[model samples]
Target chain A: MTYEVYVNVLPLKGLLDPQGKTVHQGLNKIGLSQVADVRVGKRIVMHIDANSEEEAKSIAEDACKKVLVNPVMEGYEIEVAQNA
Target chain B: MTYEVYVNVLPLKGLLDPQGKTVHQGLNKIGLSQVADVRVGKRIVMHIDANSEEEAKSIAEDACKKVLVNPVMEGYEIEVAQNA
Candidate 1:
């Protein structure tokens, strides 16, 4: 079966996100002063071939831990579903 | 009320994503050969002050269009919910 995995990798809380800050400034410049805060992260979508949903999730988690995520600064969440 | 808006900005289909390609190569190098394809995008979370959910979503969409997204090569989706 083929599973679609969505991995959201976000910076750790309390960390400084320069990119997000720049975006916030940009928004303010564009007159979006009502936007209180902005934080930016990465969303990675992968198509994986696996025996089951659990297997796909496990694979995605492993991939995230091994390569996609930087534990020093980022955390990741994985969601897996069978592709229709 | 305060609203939390999630904006997902993705590369338009058919555009080359060098970042995703690099991640895909890295995954394959680490022996996760089952991953068929990988696409990487951005997730921007914003806190906005708005009177209603529709207003919050509209604000987020405007921000995406004005600053966060490059419409020439990207597309975006916005989701909004009231903050607790």
Candidate 2:
């Protein structure tokens, strides 16, 4: 079965997100002062070939942990579902 | 009320994502060949100060369209929920 695995990679809590801060300052300079903060993260959508939903999730989790995320500075969450 | 707005920004179909292409090539070089494709996107988390959910969603949608997404090459979806 083919499953869709969505991974959200976020900077670890309490980490300084330079990208987010840059955007935040840009927003304020452009008159969007109402936007307090901007937290940017990657939303990766992967199509996995697996025998079951469980297998797909694990594959995605493993890939994310091993390659996609930087464990020292980032954290990730994976959500899996059968593709329509 | 404060609401948490989640935005998923995806490259429009038929548009070339240089970042995804580079990552794909790197993955193939490193021997993660079972992975068919990698589509990169942004999942933005925003705290919206609004009186209702509708307002927060609209704020998020407006920000996404105006500043976050490139309308010619990208599309976005926003989901809103109240902060606990």
Candidate 3:
């Protein structure tokens, strides 16, 4: 079976987000100060071949640990479902 | 009301994703070639004050067009909901 997996990686809460900060400042300069608490992250989508959703999720999580999320700076969430 | 919005920005389909290609190649070399069709994108979360969901979504999309996404390099989707 083939599963579609989605991973969302973000800077750990409470961590400084320079990129987000830069954008936030830009927003303020552009007069969109109504927006706040901005955080930037990565969303990765991929297909995995596996026997079941659980197996696919495990594989995706393993890959995330190895290359997707940098533990020192990031955290990630993963979801898996059989591809249509 | 404060709305929580999520924006997912991705390289347009059919555009070459060098970052994703590099990661995919790395996976193949590391013996995890079962993963394929990998695409990498950005996820941004923000809080916006708006009168309604539609208003929040419009604000979020406008921000995406103005700064969150580079039209030449990416496309984005925005989702808005009342924040708890």
Candidate of highest DockQ: 1
Error of 2 at B73 (Å): 1.0
Query: C-alpha displacement of A83 in model 1, angstroms?
Result: 1.0
DockQ category of candidate 1: high
User: Clashing residue pairs, candidate 1?
Assistant: none
Assess each model's interface with DockQ, reporting 2 decimals per model: 0.90, 0.63, 0.81
User: For all candidates, what are the clash counts?
Assistant: 0, 0, 0
Per-model TM-score versus the true fold:
0.96, 0.90, 0.94
Candidate 2 TM-score for chain A: 0.92
Question: On residues A1-84, what C-alpha lDDT tens digit does candidate 3 reach at each position?
Answer: 778898999999999999889888898788887797799999998888888888888888888888888999999999886673
Ranking by lDDT: 1, 3, 2
Model 2 stretches with alpha carbons more than 4 Å out: B28-31
What is the lDDT, from 0 to 100, of the residue B28 in candidate 2? 60
Q: List the RMSD of every prediction in angstroms.
A: 1.1, 1.8, 1.3
Model 2 CA lDDT for position B58:
78
Off by over 4 Å in 1: none
Model 2 is docked with a DockQ of 0.63
Candidates, ranked, DockQ: 1, 3, 2
The collision pairs in model 3 are: none
lDDT of each: 0.90, 0.78, 0.87
**Candidate 1 vs 2: which has more TM-score:** 1
